[model samples]
Target: MPGSASPHVLLAGVDDATEAVLRTELGGRAAVRRLPSGEAVPPDAADEPTLLVVGADVPAPAGLVSALQTRTRHLAVIVVTGRAGADDTSALSLLAPAERLAYVRADDPDGLARAARSMLDRLALQHAYRTAQAAAQRRLLAGGEVARQPGEQLFGPLYHQVLIGAVAVDAAGRVIAWNRKAADILSLRNDAAGRSFPLLFPPHVRGDLREHLARAALVPSPPTLFERLGDDGAAQTLRMSAQAVTNPDGTTHTLVILEDITSSTETRRQLAERTSHALLSGDVAAAMTAGDPLRQRLQRSAQAVVDRLGVAVARIWTLDAQENTLVLQAAAGPHGHLDGGPSRIRVGDPGVGLIAAERKPHLTNAVTDDRYADDQDWIRREGMAAFAGYPLINDGELMGVMALFSRRPLPETAFESLAGIAGQIAVGISQDRLLDRLRATTEALQRPLLPPDLPTLPGLDIVARYRAQGDSLDIGGDFYDVFPLPDGQWALTLGDVCGKGPTAAAVTGLVRHTLWTAAQQDPDPAHVLPSVHRALLRENSPFCTLVYALLDPSDTPVRLRVTSAGHPAPLLRRRGGRTRLLEEHGPLLGAFRATGHPVQSTVLHPGDSLILYTDGFTEGSGAHLSREPEDLAALLASWTGPSDDRLADRLADLLFTDAVTRWAGRLRDDLALVAISAHP
Candidate 1:
C-alpha cells in the first residue's frame, strides 16, 4: 500500500492513545478524522469509513457501534477487539451486505495503523469499482470535492431519471437496472432487470451488438454505438456504450447507455429518396425542353443522368448511315479518353456498339464476371463495378445507343430509369431531324408559290412576314404577294385557304396565279376578284379567303381599291394616326359561281400604312387572341411604321407575343401579315 492515495476516513470508539497512533502511523497515507462519540458520529460520516477499535487500554464499546451501523445501511464497519472468531461478531454485524469487516488484535502504532489502513482500503476499492463519472455528469453533479460522510451520496436525484436511457448489466450481458425510457424504447413489458442483451435486438443484428460490446470492453473509456432493429419491427438505431465497473464483492459489471435515433435515421432515408425523385423529374424536363439543339440537348440529358445516378460516365452514340457503325454524339462525366475524346466503335463492337446492333438493353452488376472477362481491362479502367447500356429507337429504326458506367454496384431500377430517359432522347433527336427535312422541302415548294420579294412600287413601302402553324410541314394555306401594275400602280393580296397542308397549298397556288393573270387582263380590283372567285367555284373541297387591294396615284391622294372574298377587313392608318377600316363583305371563294366581290375604296393619306393580315391572330384559340374588330383597329392605329424598315415583321411578332396558349408557342393557324406603308 506504499504511495497509495489517501481516502476520506472517519474514526470512532477509541481513546487518546488510538487517535495518536492513527495520526502518527496513518499520516500522509489517509485523511483521518475523529468522532466525539462512538454511537453518535456526525450524520455526514455515514458514507465514510467508521472504525471501532477496542484496545487493551481503552475499554470496548458497549453495543454502541451496532446502533451506529443500524442507522447507516450502506456503511463499512471494522473491529480490532483484541480477539478472534465468533468473539468479534458484534463488529461483523455492522457491515453492509456487500461490505467486508476487518479485524486486528495488535495495539501498537503499526498494528493500529494497519487496521485503519485495511478498513480504508476496502472502502476505497468499493468506490473504485464504480464507473468513471461522465464529464457532463460531473459538471452537473458537483464541482469542488466536499468532506465525505458515512452515508453522503455523490449521484444525486437530479440525474436519476434523465432523458438518456441508462442500463446497468453484468459481465454476462444480463440486465441489472434500466431507466423507464430504455424500457419504452426497447418495448419491454414490465422490468428490464433479468433480460439478456441479445433479446433487445433482432436476431439478424445480434452479431453487431456482440461485436460492439466486445470492442467497448477492450477500450472502456470512449463509448460507441451500433444500428439494429428492435422488437417492434421498426428501424431502431440505438447509440450504446459500455464501461467496466466492479461490484462490492470484487466481481466485474458493465454499465451501458442507449440513445434512440430511429427518427433521425428515418428522416435521412426519406430525404435521400425525395432528393433522387426530384432529380429524376428535372432530368426528364431538361431532355424534353427544346431550348437547345439536338447534340447539345442530348449532351445535357446525358450529363443530368450521370449526375443524378452518381455514375462515372455516360455517352449517347448515334447510328450511322450503313447501320453497321455507331457515332458518338454526346458524352458526359469522367472516362479516360472517352469524354469528347474522338472515339468511335463499329455496330458489333464491344460495349455500346453491341447494344445498338441488337437493339436491346444490357446491364451487369459485375463487369469482371466470366461473360465480361475479355472486357476486364476496359471495365477496370472505368473503375465501375456495374454498367448499363440502352439502345434508343424511334418507330422501328434504331436512333442511338446510350451507355453509362458506375463505380458502385447499381440496382435494377437504375437500368429502368436510364431506359426512360433514353426514350426521351430518341424522341427529341427524331423530331429535330424530321423538322429539318420538312423545313428544307417546304422552302423548295414555297419558293415557286409564294412571293420571294415584294415588287418595289413608287410611293409605297411594303413588307411581309409569315409563320406556319405548329411543327407540321411548313407548307400552309396562308399566302401573300405584291406585284407591280400598269401606270405607276401596285397590287397586293393576302389570303387563307379553308384547310392546311398539301391540298390547301395547291388551292393557294391556283388563287395566287389566277389573281395575277386576271390583273394582266384588267387592272381593276372589282373586276379581277369576280374572275378569281369564278375560277375557284368548281373546287368545293378547299376554299379561300382573300383581301385584294390595288394602289393607284392617278389623283392627288392615292386611291386604295380593295375587294374582299370573305376575309378579315383591311385597316388603313392615316397620317394623323387615325385608323379606318375598309370593311368589304363578299361570299367565300368556291362557294358560289359569279360571286360579286365588291370593291370598297379608301384614300391613302401621306405617312399611312394599309394592313392585310390573316385570321390566325384574331381567331387563334389562346388567352390573348383578339377576336374583336376594335383590337385590330387599335393596333393598326398605333403603328408608326411608314418610316421604319422592320415594321412588318415587328407587327407580326407582337400579334402572338401576348397570346401564347399553345405548349410550344406555335400558332393554331398559319399567320400571314403584309403591310404597305405610303412613303413620306
Candidate 2:
C-alpha cells in the first residue's frame, strides 16, 4: 500500500497480476482490503472505505454490478478497464451510478497513482466543506434560538455563537448564566452560572458592571455601551446594551447584550485624546468677541474643526427661548442646505430623526440600515450617509445639539471628538446667558437714578412724566426741572438731549443742574437761558432745545416769561377753552456763546394751563397731530375741564397711549411731558 492508512479495494476479477498492481498504488494511502467477485461486502466497509478498484475484463452476474455498487456507495470506487472501446464504454456507463469513482486503464501504473491522489484530494475538499457548513448551520440555529427565547435564557447561546465571552449578572453581581465561549476564554467550566461575577472579573470592572446594571433596571430606557472586563487580565473592552425584558407574569429582567469591541474602544479613547488636544489649541478667548465679529470667529472655528477632522458637514444649533425650538446657528459643508431653510427644530419632534427628539447623542454608521428605516425619507432628503448628534446641554438642560454628517460611514470612534466639541459649545452658551442676565440687572438698577419726581409749587398743579423708548438698553436723555426762584416765582424747564443713553443722560443732568443753578441767580427766564447756553457751548457740544419759564400765579395774567433754546413751542390753554401755540422763541442752547437773545413772555390767567414737552410727544404720527406744534396745540384745545389731575392724566394718555397705538406699539424717541395749570 502506498500509505498503509486504510485500503478497501473492490476487485471484480480474480487475476493476481491486476490486483497486485492496484495494491502497489494504494499501499500507504489506505489499508488494502480485497473483495471477491461473488462475495458480499462487509456492511461496515460499505459505509467507510479508503479505496475501491474494479477489474474491467471480468464478466459479472446481471444484478452483480448494481448490488455491489449499492453496497460501496459511500466508498471511493476505481475501475481498471482495458483500452478497448467496448470495455471502456461499458465501464463508463456503470460509473455513472457511483459517486467518488474514477476509471483507469489496466496497463497504466502512472494513471493509477494519479487517480488515487485525485480521489484523496476530492475527499479532503469535501470534508472541509462539510465541516464549515455544519459550523455555520450550528451558529445560525443557536443565534435564532437565542433571539426567540425569553431574555433570561438568551445570554448563553448568543455569546457562544458570536465566539465572545459573556456572562449575565444581576444588580447584585451574581451571574445568572455563562456561555461556552466564556468557559473557553476564562478557563472556568464548572458552576460558573451561579457564581458571583466579581469573583471572576476584577474589582473595578465588577463595580462598573453592577452600577450599569442597577441603572438599567431602574430607567425606562437604559443606556448602552457600558465597559466591562474580560477573562484576560488585560483590559478587554466591552459594550453592554441593556433592554428591559418583561415576562408574562410581569416580572422584569434586563437583557444585556455584551460585545467585545476592544480594538474599537481603544481607537475611540485615542481619538478623544487627540480631539481634546486639538480643541484646546483653538483660540476660544479670541472667538468670544463682541457683536458680528464674535459670530464670524465662531463660524471660522466650526469650519476649521470640520476641515481638520474631515467631517462632511458640521452644524451648531442654538435654543430659541421664545420660540422654544432649536435653530441652526451656523453650518458649513457642500450639502450645508441640510441646515438651511427654516432650520428650526421642535424639541418634541423627531427633527433630523430621533436624535433631536431624545435630546441625547445618536449615531448611525449606515443611514440605510434597518435601525433608520423609519427615518429613511428624512435621511435621503438631507443626503445623509452617516450621522452623529450630541446634545448641547447647559446646566443639565438640553439647549441644543451639535451634529456632524458624512457622505461615507464613520466608525463609532468618530463621535467622541464631536461630543467633546458639543460640551464646549454648551459652556459657551451658558456663559453668554450669564452675561445677558448681568446686563439686564445692571440696567434695572440704573432706572431709579433718572428723573425721580416733579417738584410741587403753590397755585399751580404740575405733572411730569418720563418714559424710556421701546425696550432699549440705554437710558433716555429727557429731563424736567422745577425749582423756586429767589423772586418767589417757579422756574420750570423741559428739554431733550440730542441722543439717548448714558452719554445723553449725562448731558441732560448737566443742562438740568445748570438751568436750576442759573435760574436761582437770575429769576428771569431770558437770563437763565443765556447762562445755561454759554455753559453748554463751553463744553463744545451740539445744540440742545429747552423751554425755560418763570410763572407768577399772583399776577393778573399769571406773569409768565418763557425762553426757547431751539425747543418746541409751549401750548397755552385759556380758561375759556381756547388754546394757542406760543411760537415766540430764541435760538437753541449751545448754538452760540451767550448771544443775548431776549426771553419771550406769555401770560396765563387763572384756570388756564401751560404745557411743556420734548419732541417725543409731538413727533408721534397720531390722528391728533401731523407735527410737533400742531399736536401740542390740538391736545391743549381739546381739554374742556379745568386743568387738574384729570387733564394731566388725559395728556399723558394722549401722548403715550394714543401715539403707541398709532405707531404700532413702537417708540422711536424718548417722551417727556410737563403740565402746569392755574387753580380756580
Candidate 3:
C-alpha cells in the first residue's frame, strides 16, 4: 500500500467560487493547492496520489490537458467544460485513459466538485493497487510468502476494481486467481477460478493462447498480441500481454493482462478503408480519362479495383443498346478472361443484368447464400465471400453494370465505394458514346460540303485528296472542288475557313457556291476569288484562305490560271522531276475589301503537274514538326513514283504517312490537296 500520506488536489484556471465549492466538497479529504496563473500544470512529482482540476475559462484547456497527461503518469484529471467547446472537451477524453479522466459542465460547480471527488477515489484505489502489486511481485521473486496485511487483505479488494482484466494462471495452465474485471470482460462462469485459462477462449484460438502462455512463462519480458474472437459480424479484439511470476513455493505463475480493443481496432480499420476508397476513386477517375480506347480504359478501371481492394474478381459491362443487353467489356483477377464467362446478359437476367434492369445496387456479404446472385455453384467453387453489383446509370439512363466478388467478407464501406466507381464508369461510357454520336453527325454534315467525285476531263488527269484533322472531334472547315465551268475550262478551288463545326461548314458551302457562280460569269481566277471574298464580307462571315485555279485542258499545252487569297502557293512539278512554287500572292479573303487575289498564268506541258493544297499539309498536330512549303517542293522534286490518275491520292498518302509517323497519328489541322496534271 502507498504510504498513508494525504492525497493532493491541484486547481488551475478555476474561479474563486468553483475553488471554494471544490475545497468545501473535498474538505479534509485531500490537500488542495491553488496553482498560480503562470503554472497552469501540476508538478510531475507528488508525495502521494494527485489530481488536477481544469476550468473551462482556461485558454486552450485541451492543450493543457494533453500536456498534463504527457508530463506525468500518476495524475488524474477532472475537466470543467461548457457546452460551447464540446468538440475540444471530447478530444481531451481520448488523451487520457477513461479511469483517469472525468468531465463536468462549468455551469454546475457542484457537479464539478463531485467529479473531482470521484476521480480522487479512483486515483487512491489505483495507487493502493500498484503498491500492493509491487509487494506481491517482490515476495514472489524472493521465493518468500506474502504477509496477510498487504497481500490478500490489501490487494484483493483493489484488484477486482482495477479497470483492466487481470488473471493469474499457475504452471499447470489453470486459473489460480481471476479478478472481477476479468470475469466481467470474459463473461466466464463463476467456476472460472479452477478452469484452464486457454479453454476460456473460443475453440479456434485456444491453441494460440496455450502457445503464447507457454512462451510467456519462459521469457523475462512480457510479450503482447492482439487476438480477435467471434465471427465476422460481432468480432471482439483483445490486446493481451503475459509474463511469468515465480511463487514462494518455487512454482511458476503467469499473469495475463487483457484489454478489450475491439472498438479501437474497428476505428483503425474504418480509417484505412476510407483512405483506400478515396485512392480507388481517384484511380478509377484517372482510368476514365486515360487515352486508351473505350474498352481498354474500362478494363484498366476493373483491374484497379482488384489491385487496390484485394477483390477476387472485378468486371465491367457496357450496354449494347440495340440488343438491350449488357456485354462484359472488361474483367480482372480470377475469371479475368472475357471469352469463357457470361459475355452477354439480357436485361432482367440474374445478377448483373438484374442490377441493370432495376437501376440499383445489389450488395451481399455472402454471395453463395444470396439467391439473386447468378452462378452460385461457381461462387462456391471459388470460395467467394461477398458480392456487390451496381448499375452504371447517368442522368437516369442505364449505361451498364459494375460488379465485384471478394474472397473475404466486405464491409458496408466497400459497397459505398463501389457505388461511386459505378457512377464514374457510367459517365465514362456515356461520354464515349456521346463522342461517337458527335463524330457520326459531324461526318454526315461534312460529306456534302465537298465534291462527290472529280470530273473526268480529256487530256487532264485531275484527282484530289481531302483529309480532315485526325485529332479533332469537330468537323473540319477545309473543302475542295473540281467542276467544269463554261468555255471548256474546269475550276479547281481548295480553301480552309476559320473555326469548325456548323458555322465553318456553312461558310465552306457559301465559298464553294460563290466561287462556282462567279467562275460561270468569268473564268479568270482573280475575278472568281475576289467575288467570293466580297460575298463573305457582305454576309459578315469568318475569313478564309483559298487557292483557285482555272484549267483549260483543250489548249495545246494545257494553259492554267491559278490565284491565291492568303493561301499557300501552288507547287509546279516539271516533267523532269524539277519543282518550283508559282508566283501568286494575296491577302486572306473575307477580312478587308481592299485585299488582293493575285493570279499567275502558267502552261502545263505533258508529264507536268500543278498541286494546290491547304496549310494542314505543312502544319502537323501536337508535337510534330511543321513541313514547310519548300519541304513539300523538295518532296515533289524527289518523286520517282509513277504519276497516274491517282497521283493526288498517292502524294497525299506519302505526306500524311510522314505526319502520322512523326506525331504518332495525331494530326492537328485539316488537309485538302487538288492535283491537275496534263497527261502525266
The candidate that wins on TM-score is 3
Model 1 lDDT, full chain set: 0.67
The TM-score that candidate 2 achieves is: 0.39
Candidates by lDDT, descending order: 3, 1, 2
| Local accuracy of candidate 2 as per-residue lDDT tens digits, 514-609 | 887887787776567777777777887656888888887666667887777777888887877688877877777887655555576777666777
Instruction: Give stretches of model 1 more than 4 Å off.
Output: 1-304, 322-327, 334-340, 343-382, 394-396, 411-447, 485-488, 553-557, 592-594, 622-625, 639-667
Give the TM-score of each candidate: 0.57, 0.39, 0.68
Better of 2 and 3 by TM-score: 3
**Cα-based lDDT for every prediction:** 0.67, 0.63, 0.78
TM-score of 1: 0.57
Candidate 3's displacement at residue 475, Å, is: 2.0
Candidates 1 and 2: which is better by TM-score? 1
